[model samples]
Target: MAGNKSFFETLVMEEGGNVTFGDGSKRNVVGKGTISVPELPSLSNALFVDGLKANLISISHLSDEGYSVLFSKDYCSILKPDGQTLLKGMRSSDNCYCLEASIVSNHVSMDEQIELWHERLGHMNFRDLRTLGKFNCVRGLPKLGKKANGICGPCQQGKQTKSMHKKGKYLTTKEPLELLHMDLMGPMQTESLGGKRYIFVCVDDFSRFTWTYFLREKSETFDKFKMLCNKIKNEMNSNIKSIKRIRSDHGREFENATFETFCNGLGISHEFSAPRTPQQNGVVERKNMVLQEMARVMLLNNNVPRNLWAKAINTACYIGNRVFLRPSTRNTSYELWKGKRPNVSYFHTFGSKCYILNDRDQLGKFDAKSDEGIFIGYALNSRAYRVFNLKTLSVMESSNVVFDDTRLKSNDHEEEVIFSDVSPLEEVVVSPNVGTSNVNNDDTQPIDRVPLLDSKEPAPWVRKLHDKEDIIGEVNESVKTRRQLANLISYTCYTSQIEPKNVEEALNDEFLVLAIQEELNQFERNEVWTLVPRPKTTNVIGTKWIFRNKSDEDGNIVRNKARLVAQRVLSN
Candidate 1:
């Protein structure tokens, strides 16, 4: 992080927070953006931390980004992934590595300035940034000098194995929302904390702008699609634009009657790729892979729980829209869709340790003012950060949050303490504790085993009856008549509390519907089964509803219970 605001050319003021230095003094981090220093690699996501006497560099962060930090008696060197020396630092008298270079000056040359913008745009190739500058396609881009050439360590690490997808023969859509590609990916091995197992992704062909929705079941795809339609309608009506066509693979979630009817109602043509061919819907197919890969990397790099996969994916989509450029237009999706350059100065590393103000409850003067949390994503409806609170074990959105992205996660206490914290959300199989850290508390004591008692004789209640007379006094017509009368009265009392036998009958009754919903909720809570497309060769099993009315000892109906049972006859 840079100390001075003048160090950043594109700083945003919205998401400022306090940063604590090693000396225990706190300074305000007012914004974040790219920082350029002559002869040094341009820094992306640099925080504008105010009131520091000297700029600090994190060797740990450079190592994580595929840079090698070498230290010796007199100096230290920062090398790129390919072992090329990028920067050298001298050991100070106080035994700290200080960089030889200084902060960027006001009279820096245009070439260095263009190089800085290159890093700002997610290390985009200079040719594209220059193209945008030349054509005036994107706002806030300055004129470019001759193509700035450099080896970007991050781009090399991220895209080394990736090859560009070949373009289609036909001309792409010319207007926003003219054509949309949508697809569904998942039923992930792990269900998210929100019980979401599927991601519905839609990408506009013209702008490459994408929208993602997390769904508990694939059956919800239609509902999310309808919601996106309403959102797009409101945003596009002023521009005289309407959805012209939408494309997806032949998944039942997309090819169903509900989706067809909705699209037809809006005068939108729905197109389907041929069965077994995913490339035809490659726009969203590729997007699904990219989003998942990015989210997976972020989660794994930060040692975050897999149950927050939905949050990571949501954040990935949010960042991709702002940072990624369309190859055809050399403009970011945000610029093309919203007609303005996106301000990403508020971006933070996903899963960074943060503190959220504990203002929800009254606190004493001596109490800590903030709760430790893990930064997850940005809230869509408000200007707040979404955080997973450690103490409450719940996810919340808060405007008053400070980030400590530079700190390393301590393996000593965090893993053991929070391992149980995630269990209530889902059954996660964590590795057994194997570290050598000594137990510090006297409360931990070894359990003493108790011996079992042996007995051969059976209890009186265990004996079986040999004859009917042993249990009851007698069996006669008078006793049978009494029993019949009791049963008849019970049946008459419950005549108004009938139970449904089938789904059709259950749907007609409000009480039965509520009972069914409760049962479904239980299934979801337990993560019984993920909803998925039916295989062609496998016979589909049918289900039946078994409903019952529970009565108290007074014969008053107490509760309506419903169970969804599979028909075994169909399985045969």
Candidate 2:
């Protein structure tokens, strides 16, 4: 269990050794757990005593397993009866059996640990990543310092952009569906689960909830948008209803007369960013950036094939929605969006080892009942998990599976008290940056798609980072126009709250953890996907989270919101 870093024993030894302490106290080892690592596939037993200072191996146990111990003048050797030595032990200068083990002490400073984690997590924003160290999510992670310093190369390479104007502020709203931030990402290096090359992302400004859809072409955006609008309108069903407004880039797919007409017909307002100024729609653009970054790491680190990129992004967005803290609110996105809390107890490390039970396969008397696989993410539509089966080389979801998260699972099942009580739902005012805003600027012309050159594919994010400053990052003075700013005081105040960085921190609060799980159960209830044998020559789409926090009419925090989506990949 991660709760216990080191193991010892006090279970009353059956037939072990006894060493007298200076104070004449003695300890007997009785309880044991398997001690295994990649280097030692099967180290039989480890004790559970809390007070023991040193680790000891039983000589008799080794002998019983067909080994002989030989004593030399200066050293000792454990060997097979035929004289083949397995391990060599040295006599310490203190005349003790210094079991020839190389003990390396690891001491890491908080800053250094932060830097290492920055690399491990693919150089995510330092401010958001600081809590990973604080939560002790990974073993050997030291207590983190409050601040992080130093620039990373990959971040400088992939995310660099000219600084933006400091004056742009947030817009506020009263509830979910009041406003939606929409954006498109496309024309990629690879195809997705459905052969899609584009992704449509929709974010709710009030709850900070986001939803994503994969498309084969830009024309498909409107249809997807309408579908979500209908679903949300029906779900929210109340005296106060419908999407009040939508904010997006000045792309033709959105700003054209037809799109405007559609939105207006539904009592929804349409707004566009200034020409070449995506920061005006920074909320969803940033959402896209986060989704892409997370997908990149999950795929690259896990050795998942590029074809699974869609699954990775989808899964990232799903996880992000449940755990990521929205700066402007005290509650997470899931809590605010849904009145009840979410439960997230089943979340496991992406890319870790897992075993899927082969219940579908009729096993012979000697057949292996489980297939070894890599942990990917949660199943889209079920209470099972999605895994990449090494044998089938396909992704599948199943409930009858086991996880080898030795470093994460706690041995004790007792309730951990992170919070004393669950808080009641509070009103949440959606930020204009996230969802709803009244835009009157109709003068900007629609943007036409520039045909891709046959000789060049889209520039990698690392390359685009340098050229996209005009559209993203810093606001330039040269491009400044006579644009009026609204009363941005509420938006300014919203950015000052203590938002959570990851699920681990949220898990520290027991109420939030249960809330996370309940949120996941919704997907299962919705029948998002099914667990089945991997079909030959077919791609199983991956899934993930996009999280947020909703605020009340007065801009006080509400709850966290999570969205599970597909990492839509491009088909070959």
Candidate 3:
């Protein structure tokens, strides 16, 4: 947090009644609200007493916020139900637990001021503010404390429930989709992109990877279930095995004869929770809550319109599958569900300012060649990006995208695009990017073809690769080199951040300049070329400079290299 004063004004005094402190001294309560903290939600119901020297939270309040408070001989913490620490408090000299603050103001401790600003800022999530705070992402944001207590009162108020989820009632499943939790949400204030008013969700008990489907009517759920079942049957590990069991609320969508007959036909058992008891289907029930909250934050942060609710849900599901932890597998839901490590290197911040190549829709020679857009999600069925064109007010998918993922974001191409290989759509990954990020197509291949440097007639050199080639080629000693093959195959190294754009830029850097000079010296020493009178009709060849970087064992840049090479440019 920047520009936040160290001390605050004792500005607004209230006539609240007195309260007793842990030290047995009573003080007049001046003000109270949830305080912002890192990682956790706002600390709820924290009172601002007139004369307390330390920050304090009541143990009972933590319990109300669904956190477990633990005490040791000299340490303590407020933890989530899964035992992850939310806030760590140290035991003071008086044997009282006290949380340390990096920056405090007034006797009031800027928490109240933050609460005021927080509401003024449309009550954006403290976590979002904390992240966006790094680069002055928003205006009037005070420097924030490094840690926050996870107790947002408004957030809790929106989710007040009749009963808490029973943590130990269900055992974790061992196989993917061994049990499925189903739920529906909606009748939202805004309709989705496809005119949907409801969303149907499914959760895998073992992998915890959630799937979301939009529906215009509740009756459509039965049909969605059948579609999901058939999809699972085709994509599942074994074709013979089908869904074993399903758990859902006793809503008519899951209880009616149509749903029952479909499950019975597949030999799947359906488990329905008791009436009005939603915690029994807590898995998908909880997933819906998380998805809605995530969507709210994304739409709010990007200033996107409400009509794109379906896009937000798509992005939310994608993020949840990749980011959330699945306790049963001790890895991400994507890995367990896909059976391959998910590739996340291509991920860019959602809703960041960006531009798409206007190659197909350019107006004229002088018109702009890139259209302004905002990143929304990944493109389906391709290794491409999905974006909302700010000018066109429509969503389109393209791989030729550039992004400025910083507070200084603008339409100008000032900074380099976060990703380099936004080439035209080509086969790069095996699966569509649903909610899961894709691994590079080459990642699944055993080994990459070695880079080439020699010939230039068609291109340098590449091997025609087959699956078993690298597995035994090294030991077989019969693998062909550049001359062994009849027709040469061309392969280039993947696009990267390092490779110089032009020879002029390469020569400006000392390392590259020296590398090029060294190559020239080698050419002279070998007597490769000499100055001579120009010939009138000699159809000359062309030259190009290639640049690359070298690194040592730890993957740090160690050297810059430049290669001066000749190419046979045939004249027509």
Candidate 4:
């Protein structure tokens, strides 16, 4: 009889007496069951004895089951009725025959193993699953036999999406701006920090360079498109090229009369994709999907708030332009569009903890020189990184910043960590007459600003550095200001008119402090709570302060407001 209930495959509980051993020791029998072991016939009527150490088998019981047991000096053997040996056991030091067998659950069938791996891999296709196993592509994966015979419910649901049509094998456009693909993404559930809910995306078919604009509403789509068109025309006129044709889905934003009139006035052709067929304008649609997915992952991985999605998407596009390669070519989107390589020396990990110099605010001798912030994106108008300052609860662009990207904040050590590509002693190159900041500012500068010393008479700084700088090491890129003025106008709402994240931040603002005082006075007047002696066994109900900016119908903040709220504490 087996001692552990886990060894039984089938069990039945019954009122039973104690089982006596040879030493007159007894264990209470709790249940009777069938035990299934690997490479052995199922043992029936095995008693589960509580407080028993080792399992016991009776030779008389085996004989009754048509098996004969013979004990030798050193071993014991069991034989079937036909005289074939069933099992053999070795004699232990205690002179007891011990049988060795493994539990059935410990071994897995080939099909079960394959199915387990399939589920672990997020329900991958069986063909690829077997390929991975066959080639040992993944460690710890055994040789897969075949797909599981049973259908997976999740696979049927998730993989049922219809595939898109095959992409064309040839390049359709020969130059940048020859053909452009445009698409609009949102009305997202969560509005961005700047109250943007939609992303207007544009792509050049040839270079695959993508541009994205955050919009507050659908009506802003046309304005952004017109601005992009005007900017592109001005920039491409010298190359004898302009936006020749554009493709987009038949959304009301793109198919409107005003949009058509604008395109017709510029002698540009506007083509509409078939209804519900995103593949026709797949260039920008795919880019939109990629950008959104990238943004989602970055936000989730870094635990950044969802309201910062626009910053993540914009940074994704900014990086993709310089990093993603053009199909069937060794050139990048930046190179194909600008006729020169793009430099990404200044790129930092998004959502990285940073310190922005507190030059904008007045500081005393012992005051902090910098404010803690999170690196968001790059600035369009200047050589700077966009940071979301924790103290102000606002986003701003600043050239003077220090990034702490590598180490965890919970770590005790405070040694500064810098990017691997730049060296500590590397000199910062400055313009002809401009004074230099540190390496941080120089790296953040646009690549096109590589100083040129062509006058035969070198500048004083140039003479200090071998009379010339290595211009070939730098890339000449033309920056496109998609909505520079519009961004500046929008940025003020987020920076200057800030909404406090907590009571601590609210205390620092004079307006918010007044708002908080007014809220407390209103609460007292309404008799919200009464002072009482604390009960030793009772827990206190905590409180929280919520701060908001009261805005007018014209979308301008008119007043700072604060409210006291009882914190919700959930109990088990």
TM-score of 3: 0.45
Model number with the top TM-score = 1
lDDT ranking from best candidate downward: 1, 4, 3, 2
Worst 10 residues of 2 by lDDT: 447-456
Clashes of 2: 71
TM-score of 2: 0.47
Better of 2 and 3 by TM-score: 2
- lDDT (0-100) at residue 195 of candidate 4? 55
Q: Please, what are the lDDT tens digits per residue for candidate 2 over residues 149-185?
A: 4565445545556784342244487777777999999
Whole-model lDDT values for every prediction: 0.66, 0.56, 0.59, 0.65
The best candidate by lDDT is 1
Q: Across residues 1-572, which tens digit of lDDT does each residue of candidate 3 receive?
A: 11112222112345568877567988777765545543444454455677666555567767876889888988787788888876667788988876545323222444554444343333445555454443333333444543335454444544446786643344477678789999989777865534467889999988887778788789999988888887787777465456799999888888999888888888889999989998778788878877776666555444444556676677778766754546523455777787655544465655666777765763686666677766777766666777766555457877777765543212323232222222221211111112323323211101101111111122223234447654753665765453422222111111122668789777444335545655765687579987888899797767889898775464545556678777746533
Report the C-alpha lDDT of model 1 over 315-387, residue by residue, as the tens digit: 7787678767776556788888887776555556666667778879897987777777666767656667677
Where model 2 places Cα greater than 4 Å from the true spot, the runs are 1-171, 238-240, 405-572
lDDT of 4 at 394: 59
RMSD in angstroms, candidate 2?
Answer: 24.7
Candidate 2 local Cα displacement, residue 48, angstroms: 32
Looking at candidate 1, the ten consecutive residues that score lowest on lDDT are: 442-451
TM-score of each model, in listed order: 0.50, 0.47, 0.45, 0.47
**Residue 322 displacement (Å), model 2:** 1.1
